[model samples]
Target: MSSPVPPQHARPKRAMAVVWASAAFVAVSAAVIIVHLAGAPSGAVEPSSYAASNAAPGAPQTVAVGPSSSPAAKPSATSPSAAVTKTAAAPPQEPPKAGWIPVDQAAWQAQVAAFKARKIDPVPAGVGNLPEFRADCQYSHRLADDPIVFPDMPGASHMHSFVGNKAVDAHTKAGDLTKFTATTCKPVVDHSAYWVPTLYDAASGKPVETTGFRVYYRSVRNNSTGIMPIPTGLRMIAGDAKKKVPTPRGAQGQFYCAFYGPGDLDGIARSTNGNWPICGGDATLHFMLQFPDCWDGKHLDSPNHKDHVAYGSDKGCPADHPVRIPALTFDIQYGVKGTTQGYYLSSDTTGRSASSMHGDAFLMWDSDAMNKRTKDCIAQRRTCDNNGYLH
Candidate 1:
C-alpha cells in the first residue's frame, strides 16, 4: 500500500477504465430491449386458434396493445360492445326453402293483370265441342322425391314416377320451373311437373313404370264461363295417398282397362287380389285422376295442398272458391297384361292394393300460351290437342 501511494495518477486511470466498462454494459442492455420491442406487438396476449378461425367473415378482430398490465386493459368475455359487434357481423337467418308458404300476393296479382291484357277470341262455332287441352308426356325418371309435398327434403317420400319438367326433384320450386325447359311433355310450352306413386309388381318386387301419361286440362262443368287460366304456381293433389281400403273392380277411382277397339273399360278379369284390372285383348291398365276446377283466388297452395281448390258443380263454382280454373286430369297408362300376384303402389304401406294411388301436379306454363289456350279452348268449350290446336 505504501508503495502505491507514490502513484496517484495511476489510481485515477484505473478508475476511468472501470467507468467505461460500466457504460458499455448499459448500452448493450438497451440495444437488446429495443430489438425485442421491434420484433413483436407490445402487451398482446396470444389469441386462441379457434377464436381466430371462427370469426365471422370480414369481421374485425379485437386486439389490445398497450403498456398497462391491468385486467381493465383487456377485453371482457361478455362485454356489451363485443356482443353487439358479433351480432352485427353475423348473417340474417333465412326462412325455409320450401313448404306451403304463401304466394307473393303483389307478384301474383301482377301476373293476373298481365294475363288479362292478352286478348284471345273463341274458335268458330262447331269447330270443337269439348272444353279441353292436353299435354302428352313420357316417363322421365323415378325417385323417392315429391316437390309439392316434401319440398327441399330429398328422399323423404316413397318412390314416385315422374313426368314433365325433367329436372324436377324434391328441391324444385314453383318459380324455378321455367328455367328448366327440358321436359318430357310435348308442346314445350307446358313446363308443369307431375308425379305419382311408383307401381311395383308384388311378385318380383320390380317396378312397372308408366308407358303413356296424358295430362288433360279441361272444364269440368258444361259452363266454361269464368274459367280463368290456371295460376302460374298452382299446386294440386288428387286422390288420397293414404286410402288403404281395397280398390275392388267396382270401387270408385279404381284402375281400369283401356283399349282402342271393342273391350270392357273395367277389364275382362281382375287381379289375384282384385285390386288391379286384368286387361283383355289389346287393352292396358289405366288410371284416371281428376283434380279440382275451382280456386279460392287467394292462396296458390294450402295446408292440405287441396284446400285452395274445390270441385265446381254443373252450374258454377262454389261461393267460397269463386275463381274457376281448368280441371286437371292425369290419364296414366301402364303396359303389362296383369299378373296373378298383382301390384302395389309405393305409398301402399298395407302392401295389399292400389287404393293408395294418387297424383300430384305443379302447374307452370308460358303466360301467353296459358292465357290464349284458356281463352280459345277452355272458355270457348273447344277441344285442343297436345299442340294447343283444335283437331
Candidate 2:
C-alpha cells in the first residue's frame, strides 16, 4: 500500500516550517531597528550655541543662526559627497576716516560709477516749482557728542541734539549709519545723521530740545543742471560754532520768527541782549541753516572740515569745488516761546548768542534710493515731500 503514504501527516510538517520562517523574519527586523537606533546621527544643536547672550538689555532678542537658518543646503550635484560651495563674503569695511582724511579710493570709485549710471530724467509736466526734496525727522537723542567734530571721543564735545539716524554716537561713522537702519527720519532710506549744538533755557538753565526738524535737500541756484548726487561719506558743518557776535534783528544767520499766516518773520519784541527774537501770537522760534552746495570731488573731509565744500554762485559752483551737490538746509523749530531773557547755545555758554548755532551732517544713504531721488526730483527741479512724491 506504498507504506501508507508516510502515515499521512504532511499538514503538521508544513505548519511548523511556516512558524519557523515567520520567527526568523521578526528577529531580522528587530536587529535592523537596533542598528539604526545605535548608529543614526542626532541633529540637535547645543542650546548655548544659539543663545543671544550678547544682546543688550531691553533690546529685541535675536539669535544669529547664520546660513543654517535657511533651508538645509543640498549636496553638490557634481559630487554627492561634497558640500555646496558657499560664496566668499565681501571684505570688512573700515570705519570712515574723519578730519584730514581723504576719501577711500575704492569706495569713491564705486559710488561714482553708480552715480554715473543713474538715469537723468526730465522734469515731469505739472511738477511743483520748488527744486527741493525733504526729510522730516523727529528729535532722536541728546548727548555730549559730535561725531563729525569729536569722533571716537565720548563726552569730549558739547551737548548736541541729534536727529535722523538713531544710532549716531560719538564713535559713529558714516558707514556705521548703514548698519544701524533705525532712524527718526521719514523715508528711512536716508540714513544720514544730523546734529546741532543743544539749545538751553536761559531762565532755568535746562535743555530746550527741538520740537520739529526738517532737512531740505535742494539746489540754491535756479539752474539745477550738472548737479551730481552728494558723495557718500561726505561730512559738512554749516555755521561757525566759534562765532560769538551779536545777532541784531536784521543780522544774517540770525534765528527768526516763523508763523502760519500774515506775520512778520522778524519778531515783534527783542531779547534783553538784542540777540534773539521774542515772537508773538501763534509764532515760535525758528532757525534755518543752509549748507554749501558745491563739492571738491576730492576729499571727503579736511582738517577744518569746511575746505572740501564751497558756496555756489547764481551761475554755478566754483572751480575749486567744481562738483555741484544738493544744498542741505536745517529748518528747525523750537516749541518754547521766546522770552526777553533769551536762550543759550551749548557752544556759546558765555556769550549766549544764536551766532554760535551750527549744524553737522554726516551723509550715508542707500545708493539706489539717493540716485533715484536726485535724478527724478532734484535734478528735475521738482518739489518732493518726505516720500519723494510731488504734492
Candidate 3:
C-alpha cells in the first residue's frame, strides 16, 4: 500500500526521465566541441595517416607531411625521416678554421718561429739563395681576370686571391694551367701559383681571405743568377696597380706595415692603409708582395705582363734583363673583422689609388712540380716551403 502511494505519476514519470537525459548529454557534448574545433592546429596533433599523393604539376588533393621534431631536420624524399643525424665526414684537421678558433698551440708555434726567423739582411741583388725558399700558401679565392689587364676579359680584375692555381684567371693561358694534376701546394715540389689584393671592408662589400701564402723564392745576388724554371708560358706583372702595395719595401716597388703575433698573444701588427687592417677579436688581413727578379732570357709572356719582367737592380739583371730567376714574396693572410676604410687592387681596374694598385701572375706549373722546384729548391740553394720540402 505504501509503495502504491509513491507513484505520484511515478514521480512525474521519473522527473521526465531525468530531463530527457540532461538534454541528450548537452547534444553529445556540443558535437564533441565541434569536432575538436574543426580538427587541430596549435593544439597540434595530426598524424593518423592519409595517402594518395604526387602532385606538383597542378598540385591539389595532397597528403604528404611529416618530419620536424627538429634535430637538424631534413626529411622529404617524399617523406622518410627520423629526425636526421646522418654524420660521417670529419678527418681533415689542421687549422682553427671552420668558424675559426686559432690562437693557441704555443701561439701558433710562435707565429711559426717568427716567420722562420725573417732575415734578408743585405741580400737583394747578388741573385742566388738570398732568401732561398718559402712557399706556404693557404688563403685562396677572389678574381677579376688579368692576363696583363684583361687579356680578353675574364672578369677584368681587382679582387685577387689565387693560391696554387685552381686554374687562375683573366682568360688563363699558361696553357690553361698545364694539365691540372691537383694541387694546393706543399712539397709536391712547388706547384707554383699565387695571388693577392683582396681584404675587404670597403664599406662592406665583404671579403677577407688570404691568411697564408709566403712564396718567397729568393736570389738577391750571390751566385748573382742561378735559378730557373718559371718559363712555361710564363706571364707576369707584380704590384703597382696604383700602389697599395701590401708590404713591398724597396729595391723594387716596396711597401709595409708589418706585425703578426707572439709578443703576447695576437701581436698586433697594423698600419695598413690598403694592406687593409682589421685584425684580432678574430684576426685576419695581411699582404707582402714582391716580384721581379729580372728575366728577359726570352719571353714566354709579354704583352705587358711587365714587359718581359725586370727589376733586380742593386747591380744585377740590368744587362738587358740578362737572367736571374727566383724572386717572389707574397705573404697574404686575411680573416678580417672590424676596422676598415681603405684597401684596393684587383689591379685597380681603373679606380687606382691604393697607390695605383696592382697584382697579376700566371706561370702554370706542375711541370714535374715546376722542374722539381727548379732542380730541388732553387738549384739546391735550399730552404723550401712551396712544398719542395726542407722546412
Candidate 4:
C-alpha cells in the first residue's frame, strides 16, 4: 500500500507516453493515404489538382483561330445575313496562263459601268462623210445542240446558241442561209447567224436565260486596213475551243464580269470548277468575245477555224489573211444566279474539260446588206451598227 502511494506522479508520465504513441500512429496512416492516392489508377485524384476557391466567378472561355490579320470566319451580329461567311482562308487567285492576260478587276468594273451608262438609241447619229453601219444582233436560238461538222450524233460535237438568222441548223448552207428572213437584229439586213454556248443552271441541270443580248460588228483597226465582205461560205471559230485560253488582263475584246447582283453581282466569284463567277444566287455572269478583222480570201473554212483569220495591227492586215472585214463582237449576257458548287459551259458536253467553251459564226449575210456593208460602211472605214449609221 505504501509503494502505490509513492507512484502517483509516475502514473501521469505513463499516461502521457500512451497519448504520444497514438498521435504518431494516426500521422503515419494519413501519409500512407496520400502516397496511395498519388500512385492510384486513373479514377483516383489528388485534392491539390483542383482549385478549392469559394470566391467569385471569372471570365468566360473563347476560341481564337489564327494571327490577328485574318478576321474570324463567323458572321457578326450586325453583318448581313446573305454575306458570304468566311469559313477558312481564301485560296490565292489562280496564276494567269501563259500568253493569257490577267483579269483587271478595277479596269473591268470601270469599263462595265461605262457600257451600262452608254446611251444607245434605236436610231443612231451618222458622221459626216462616214456612213455608220453596225449589226446589232440579239439572242435568238440554239445554233446547234449538235455541230454542223457532225450533226445527228449525240456525242460528236459541242452545243451552240444561234441568233440573227432564223433558218440556221446542222446543215445550213450559205446560199440558203443568206436568203432574206426575219431576224432579231436591227435594220432587218442582218440575216447572218451568230452562235455561242447556251447556259445551263449548275444546280438544277436545267437551262438558264438572258433578258438582254446585243452584238456589234465594227472596224476596230489602227491602220488603213482594206475592207471586204465575209466570203459566201465562211465558217469559223472564235476564241479557244480546245485550250483553256487565258484572256489577257485589260483586253477589251475579251472580258469577264459580274453584274446586277451583290459585289460579285451576286454570282460566284471563284467556283470549284473554275467558272470565275459561280452563280448560286441572283447575279449574272458575262463574257465578250471579239473576232478577227483580217481574212484570207481564198479559204472559207479552215481545218482549224482560227488559222485563216488574223487580227489586225497598226501596220495593216497580215500577208496570210489579207482580206479585212469588220471585227465581229459577241456581247453575251447570261442570267445565272448561282452558288459556289460549280458551273457548266453551254458548250460543255464533257464535264471534265473547257475545250467545249467556244463560239462559232456562219457567214450568211443578206446579199444587199453584204454588198452595201462592203461597199459603203466597211470600205469607207466608218463605224456602223444595225440601228443606223453611227460614227
C-alpha local distance difference test of each model = 0.62, 0.63, 0.40, 0.43
The stretch of ten residues in a row with the least summed lDDT in candidate 2 is 45-54
Per-residue CA lDDT of model 3 for 1-391, tens digit only, reads: 1011110000111111111111111112222222322432111011111110001111231111222223233232233323222211221222121121112345334433443343322322222221245544553334443444555444334445566645454554444455442335454344446665554444433444554444555554444344455554555666455443333212122222222222211123333343333334333333344567777765655544565767654356667777667665454434443344544443342332344434455655544445555555455554333343332
lDDT of 3: 0.40
Ranking of all candidate structures by their TM-score, best first: 2, 1, 4, 3
lDDT digits (tens) for residues 28-101 of candidate 1: 22222223223331211111111000122233422111111223432222322121121112222432344455
> Whole-model lDDT for model 2 versus the true structure?
0.63
Q: State the lDDT of candidate 2 residue by residue for 1-391, as single tens digits.
A: 1111110101122112111111111112222222322332111000111100001112222111111111233112122222232221221243245556687778777876887788766554544645667687777766566777766655556667887776676677666677666677777898898989888777766667777776778765657889888877889887787788888777655776655344555678888998888977766777766677888988888867888987775578788989888878776767766898888887787787888888999998787777777777678776666666453
Once fitted onto the true fold, the runs of candidate 3 whose alpha carbons sit more than 4 angstroms away are: 1-143, 146-151, 156-158, 161-194, 202-215, 218-228, 232-257, 260-329, 332-360, 364-377, 380-391
The segments of candidate 4 whose C-alpha lies over 4 angstroms from its true place after superposition are 1-132, 143-147, 151-155, 244-255, 258-268, 272-274, 278-283, 349-356, 374-381
- lDDT sort, best first: 2, 1, 4, 3
- In the range 297-388, model 4's lDDT, one tens digit per residue, is 55666555566777665467888877677666554555544445444554443452333445677765654456555555545544444533
TM-score of 3: 0.25
Error of 1 at 137 (Å): 0.4
Model 1, CA-based lDDT: 0.62
